[model samples]
Target: MRVIVVGAGEVGTNIAERLQDAHDVVMIDRDRERVESITYDQDVLALEGNGTSLETLEEAGLERADMVIASTDIDETNVVICGAAKAMDDAFTIARIKRTNLLRTWERSEEAFGVDFMVCTDLHAAEAIVDIAGLPGARDVDSFANGLVRMAEFDVKPTSPIAGETVAEADRYESLTFAAILRDDDVVIPEGETVIQPHDAVVVIGSEESVREFAGSLTPAPTLEQANEVVVVGGSEVGYQTARLFEAAGLEPRLLERDPDRARELAERLPQTLVLQSDATDIDFLVREHVDESDIVVAALESDEKNLLVSLLAKRIGVGRTIGVVEYGEYADLFETVGMDVAINPRLVTAEEITRFTREHRTEKLAMLEHDRAEVLEIEVDADSVLCKTRIREVMADLPEGVVIGAVTRDGELITPRGETVLEGGDHVVVFVDTEVLDEVAAAL
Candidate 1:
């Protein structure tokens, strides 16, 4: 497939690189330096032009392109490019929109603009923060079906009760599956006799109910609590979006904005949150707002330096946890040194989400597996497929290279199938496939 990606910034470059392995990708940007850099380093077509213009789309051969992805830093440009592409051909149009208001408004009538998909960077970043906040101990989380099923990574501490338990004992938890164990640099595929030691990172999959049960069985359960009081510095779209996420997760959010009218508007838009018209740098104001008692302090101001400064202040003042949103990807590492718990780059996050959604076509949803080189895909099997009539073990032998059935779901029931388990018609099968043979696996199914 031919794909055209607009904006050669972090998001555009990442998307082009990801799709290049599967599709003929072309990346465009207004900056000559960016275009030259990506063209020389990556195996993708890079063009220098104003992508939002119709002439540029024509030059990029949009009519023959299977998909057009507008991931420019500017939301308006992305929307305009996507609109132009859709006007030319309705194949598939995706835009990376950063403004929260635009997304909320567009979502109400997205079909009218012929937008096939909308990627909201702020929303994606907020969701990631919310997930980490909800599961404070989890290093990473991947949710399916909007959170019905989740796979989480928990670091096994030295004080954990089950530190030295074997995998067999751990699997006895009714709803849990001990997926894999990450010990330092190695990832162990556990068997019945495999023993887990202290500092081992364990990945588990199950419904929320079962996962909670599994979490409780650990020697020392990690803390999971909603933030009663939250502090958000900076009134950027990312900040507002994060505030909204906190409110939705039942956190009492207090936003600190420098502009009074903007703060008032934010207060009106997010009635659940208390928007205070005060400079985040004002230590007296922060103290008066009881920043010391806040459960979480999020630094999402425009300047990375400002965010770091505010976060450091919040941490020193005794906030439970501090998260900073870094606009520049290179500054991400500095957040950890400065005491911020997590540093999120919305552009990087949005790029990754868009790449995952666009690179693969067969599956409705795709998630990264234990190894970054592999993927776990949920595909709906055709009713009359031959594999549906055969036992899972037999089908495994005939599966295209690099694919293995991980699990299957029929009528909302999840089943871990063995050789004897038969695949029924209308089943949603979760298959793990190496990146190389994804297409072949899809064809086989």
Candidate 2:
């Protein structure tokens, strides 16, 4: 597939990197330095030109492109780029937007702005955060097989019951599969005897009920059902959306915004949420309001530094968990390393969603884990698929070391994968693949 990505920002660069291995990728940016940097560092062609210009699109070979993604920082600019691309060719167009109102407008008519698809950054990030909060001890969460199958990543602390247990011993859940173990810098395909170490990120896939049960076994943190006190800091779109989602889940959360007008607006908009006007950095205000009693505190401030500080303060005040909304991709890991429970970057989330959408023809669903070190993919088995009509154990022998069949679904029923299980055509199998062998596995499956 020929893919042309507009705006060489972090989101566009990430999409290009994910697709360059299997497709022809071309990136365009107005910044000369970014174009030059991408030209030298990446395998794809980087063009220095404006994406909204017809001549620049022609120079980037847009007429022959299979897909065009507009990911500029400005929403209007991105929409215009997609519109220009659609006017010139039949290539599928995708736009990255931040406003929910625009997303609603686009939903009424997907072709309204000449965009085939739209990814809302703030809304998706908030949904990701809410998904994490729904599962106890989960750093990341994604659903597959039409919400029948769920994949979750959990950080194994020294205090966890299964911290030192072997994979075989920890495989006690009825329908759960330990997909992979993420050590410090390695994606470890686990065997029966593989020991789970402290601080390792463990990825698991199974039915939603089974996954939730396993999560409870890993930590003593209260489940969302028992979680009574949830606090949201900042009145940013992400924060407002997060609180709104919590309300949808039948929980009334508290939101703190420093600006009086913003707080008033939030209070009027969110009848269930308690909106307070106060600086989150003020220690006295936090303590006086008994913020320490909250079960979860989410920092979604505009500035990454402010979010980091607020997360630290929440953790220091005995909050059970702290989720920080990181603006920059590089700061996400830093926030988690510095004691934040989870750090979500809206741009990265948007990029992953767009990349997955681009690959929908091959895979039913895709989730990138540990910053792209590994991936969990759901693919339907066809007559030509290697997995079709083959026992899983026999298939494993022919495949590489890092592949794990997490779960299989057929005719809307979940099937726990085992060595003796024989996969048939039309089965949607969710497998974990090391990014190193993703292309190979994806081709064979």
Model number with the top TM-score = 2
Task: Please provide, for model 1 over 102-158, each residue's C-alpha lDDT reduced to its tens digit, 9 standing for 90 to 100.
Answer: 777778985645667888998888777667556655655667544546666677878
List all candidate RMSDs to the true structure. Answer: 3.6, 1.3
Q: Which 10-residue span in candidate 2 carries the lowest summed lDDT?
A: 356-365
> Candidate 2 versus the native: TM-score?
0.97
Which residue pairs of candidate 1 clash?
161-219
Measured by TM-score, how close is model 1 to the native structure? 0.84
The candidate that achieves the highest lDDT relative to the unseen native structure: 2
Q: What TM-score would each prediction reach against the true structure?
A: 0.84, 0.97
Off by more than 4 A, model 2: none
192-255 per-residue lDDT for model 2 (tens digits): 9999999899999999999999999987788877897999999999999999999999999999
Worst 10 residues of 1 by lDDT: 218-227
CA lDDT, every model vs. true structure = 0.75, 0.92
